[model samples]
Target: MGGVGHWVVIFAIGGAQAVLLALALWRRPVNRAANRVLAAWLGLVGLDLGVKAAFLAAPAPGLFRVLLFVGVFPFLYGSFFYLYVRTLTTARRLAWLDGVHLSGFAVAFAVGLPALLAAPDTNLANMQAWLAGAFPPPVPWYSPFLYAWSLSYVAAAVWRVLRFRREVRERRSDADRVSLHWVMAMAMGQVLIWGIAVVHDYVRPAGIGYFTIYGAVAVWACVLGYLGLMQATVAGDDTAEPGAPREVPPDPPAAPPAQDEDARLPEVQARLAGLMEDEAMYLAPALTIAQVARRSGYPEYLVSAAINRGFGCTFWDYINRQRIAAACRCLADASDTRTILDIAYACGFTSKSTFNSAFKRETGHTPSAWRARQAAA
Candidate 1:
C-alpha cells in the first residue's frame, strides 16, 4: 500500500469521468435505448472503481462484505454488455426474460450476506493479512464460475457484432459508413482487461499489483466512454435500418430439370452489368443489393451470386470498383473543379477515409496522387 495514494487518485479521476459520461449518454436522444443500457454499464463500472478506491484508501472493517459486493459486478457487467449489443444490433425491446441474466448476482448476494454479519475484527484481520500477501483474500467460492459465465456473454456479444458486419455487407453498399469495428475493438479490450485481472489475481505477476490492474481499468473506462458516445445507431439511415422489412425481388421463371445455374447465370450477369453501367446504380450512396435485384428483375441471391462468381468479388467490392472507376475518370478530368471530398460524395462514398482507402487500394495511389499524375501526364 506504499503507492496506494497514487492509485486512489487515478481511480477517483476515472470514476468521476465515467460517471459524467454515463449521465450524458443516458440523456442522449439518439439511440436512446442502446445508450441507456450503455449508460448503466458505464455507471456501474464507475461505481465499481469508486468503491475500489475507497476500500484501498481506507480498509473497511467489513472487508468480506465489500469484496463480495464487488465480486458480483462481473456478472452484471457481462449481462449489460450483451444487452447493450443486442439493442444496438437488433433494436428490439428487452423482454422480462432478460432479467434472468441478473440471477447470478442475486444468488451471489444471498449466499454472501451471512458473511457480512461476521465480527468486524475477524474481517479486518483477514483484510490485513490478504493485503500483506501472507494470506488469500476472502474471495467467494463461486468466483471462478462467475468469470466463465461473464466471458460466455462477452463471447456472444462479439459473435453478434461479427454477424452484423457480415450481414450488413450483403444488404448495404455503404456498409463502411456504419462500421462496427469499434465495437470489436472494445470487446477485445474487455477481454484484455479480464486477462490482466486473472493473471494479477492468480499468478501474481511481477510488477503487476492492484495499481496496475486498476490503472488498466481506468484507461478502459475512458475508452469505453469515448466509443460509446461516438457510436451511431444502426438505424441512423432509413435505408440501413436493421429492423426494416427487406423487400424480396420477384421470383424468376422455373428452369428445366436439366438446366443448371449456368443457364441463368448469364442473364443475371447481364442484368447486373446493365444496372451498374446503364442505370449508374452504383452512384446511389445508400445503394443495396436488394435495390439492384429489384431494378434488375432478379432475386437478390442471383444478383449477389453473379457479382461474386462472375466478378470474383463481393457486392460491396463490385460496387466500389464501379465507384472507383467513376472517381478515376473524375480525377483525371482537368476541367472538373470539384474537391476530393466532393468527388468522394459524388462517387457514392459517405466517408472520406473509406473513399481514400478504396481509391488507394484499387489504384495504388491516393486520390490526390492520382490527380497529380493525371495532371502531369
Candidate 2:
C-alpha cells in the first residue's frame, strides 16, 4: 500500500481500538475499576497511534512535532496497562502511589516544554536540524530511562500474571480459559515491540524500523479489541475490600508417611464429595475452590488436588458437573414447570449461554433435548 493507504490502515486500527475501549467502559463488568483502567490504557494507545498516523500523512513542521514529542512516550501506557492487569487479577482498586509511575513522563514533558513553546520558526528550525543529524535533543538522553520504565512495568505485569495463574490453579477449576491469558499475551507483545525498538535505535537509524514497530502496535490493538469482544466479562460482587484475600496460592503437598500419603488421598476425596453431594455447595453460582476448602475444613490445595485426582478434572469442571447433574434432575422433573432459564439459574449458572454449553457438554444433548427425551421415556 502507498503512504496514504498505510495511514488509513493505521487510523482504522486505532479507531477500532477506541471503540473497543468505549465498549469496555460502557459495560458494568464485575471489576469496574479494572475495566475503566483498561479503557484508559487503550485510549492512550489509540491517541498515540492516531497522532502518529496523522503526522505520517501530513508531515507538519512545528506544532505537529511538539505533539508527537508529547504523545510518543510509552511509559504512561505501560503503567496503565500494568495497573489494569494488576487490578483485574487482584480485584483491587488503584492506590495513590500508582500515580508515581507517571512521574517519568511528567518530568520528560516539563523538560521538553521550552522547545514546544519556542517561536514557530525556531521550532521548525530545530526539527530540521535534528532530521539533518545535528546535535541531538535532550529527549534522547532520556531514551534509556523511558525504555527502562516501560520494561519495568512490563516485567511487573508479567509477574502479576504469573501469580494470578498460580492462584487460579489453586482456586478455580476452569482456569485454562480465563481472560488472564489475553493480558499475558498483550504484556509479552509489548516486551517484544519495545525490545525491537531498542535494537533499532542502536543498530540502525534508517527510521524504517519505527514503521515496523508502529505497524506491530496497530496490529496488537486490533488483536486486543477482538479478544475484548470475545472474552467473557467478569460479573460478581465488586465490593471487595482493598487488601482482602483475592487469591490463595496453592501450597505444595507435604510429604507424608508412605502409608499416610496413600490414605490421605481417599480422605480428601471423601471430604470433597461430601461437600458437593450432601452440602450441595455447588449451588452457589460464584462458588470457588477457596470457598469449598473453607467449607470442607481442608486446605485449598488439598481440595484442588483431590478434585483433580479423583474426578480427573479442574475445579471448574467438577463444579460444573455437579451443576449439570442438578440441572438434569430439574429438567427431568415433570412437576417443575419452570423455564430453562429458571432451571439454569436454580442450578447455579450465571448466564444462559454458560448453562446451555455446560449441559450439552456433560450430557450429549442440550437441556431441551434431554427434557424431551425424558418426556418420551
Candidate 3:
C-alpha cells in the first residue's frame, strides 16, 4: 500500500513539473534568464524521472531512492530560488553570489558531501556508517543551524516586500500599488514553501523523512518558474525603491482599483493625450510627479497611477514620450529657426540634459543624431 501511494505521489510531482515547464515556455513577457533556468530544471527533472522509471522494472534499493531524493531536493530548491527572484525582480541584476544570502544557500547544499565519496552504499546501514565518519558525524547543531539559515533567507525576503507595501500606501497610485502587490504575492508564496521545508527538516526522521517535503517543494518551484517566464507581464511599481522586494509582507493597497474598469481606462487615455499637447510638462528641468499632477489637473496620485497602469511606464518615461512626440513634429515641419534647446524649452523641458536623456531613451538615438538622420532622409 505504501509503495502504491508513493508511486502515485511521484507521478503527481512529475506531472506538476511538466505542466509548469510547458507554461514557462509558452508564457509571453518572460524574462530570458528566468526562461533558461526553468527550461534547465525541466530537463533535469525529466532525466530524474527517466532513471527512476527505468529502475521500476528491476526495483532499486531503498537507499538509491534516498540518494535520489536528497539530490533532487537541492536542484529543485535552487530552481525555486532562482525563478522566484528572477520573476519578482525582472530587469534587476541578481548575480549568483550577489551576497551572503546565496552564499549561505550554496553552503547548505554542500551538506551531502559524504554520500558522494563513499563506495556504493547499497543500504541504509552502509550509508549511515559512511555519513557518521564523513567529516565527523553531523551533530544536532547541524540540523538546527541549517533550518534557521534557510528560514532566515525567506524571512528576509518577506521583510523587503512589506517595506515596499508601506511606500506604496503613501503614493496611492493604483498601478504602482498593483505592481508591488504582485511581486509581494510571489515573494510571500515562495517564503511559505521555504517555511514548510524548514519545519519538515526540523521534525523529520533522522535519515530521509524530510525528503517527503521534496514533493511539496515542487509546487513552489513550478510557480516560481512560471512567474519568471511571465515576468514581463508582472509589473514593478515605479514608486518602489530601485531595488525589488527582499521579503514577503503585507503590500500597500493595489493602485486605486477602478470600480468602472472600462471608464477608468478611457479617462487615463485622455490624460495621455493631454501630456502630448503641452510643452511645459515635457520641458520641466526637474519635473516631479507632484508638478506633473498639478499641470494635468488630475491628482498627482492619479497622474502617477495612470502613467504606471494605463501607459505601462514610469512618469519619467511618460514625460519623455511627450517630448519625443513634440520633437518629431518639429522635424517634420523642417523648422530651423528654433534651436533644439529652444524647441526643448518650448516643449516644457527645463534642461537640455533632461530632454536629451528622454529623447535617447525613447528614440534610441541622441537628439542631434535623430535630427541629422531625419534631415539626411
- Candidate with top lDDT is 1
lDDT string, candidate 3, 1-377, tens digits: 12434644564566457555755563433444444445555555444543443443244455454443444334344334444444444545446654544454455455545544445544445444433423232345555655556555555655655554444333422223224444455556656655666655556445333334445544554665455454433323323343556555444334555665434666866865766564345555445566555666655556656767788876656666776787767855665667888888777665577678767878898878878888888
Model 1: number of clashes?
Answer: 0
Please list the C-alpha lDDT of all candidates, in the order they appear. 0.80, 0.73, 0.53
Q: Name the candidate, 1 or 2, with the larger lDDT value.
A: 1
Candidate 3 stretches with Cα past 4 Å from truth are 1-27, 30-83, 96-101, 121-139, 168-172, 176-212, 222-377
Candidate 1 lDDT over 159-241, as tens digits, reads 99888887787678898966677777778888887788788767986888767877888888889989887876584422334
Candidate 3 or 2, higher TM-score: 2
**Model 2 per-residue lDDT tens digits across residues 1-377:** 23456755776577567756656664645466777777676776777777766655655675456554745467686787788887777667778887897887888788777776767798787666644536354666777887888889888988888877766655664455553767877887888888777887778656446567777778777776555545443423464654567555566557556465456778888888888889899888767887888888766656776787767877878888888999999889999999999998888877777788888898999999999999898
Q: Candidate 1: deviation at residue 165, Å? A: 0.8
Where model 1 places Cα greater than 4 Å from the true spot, the runs are: 62-64, 103-114, 130-147, 235-265, 297-301
- Arrange candidates by TM-score, descending: 1, 2, 3
Candidate 3, 54: how far from true, in Å?
7.1
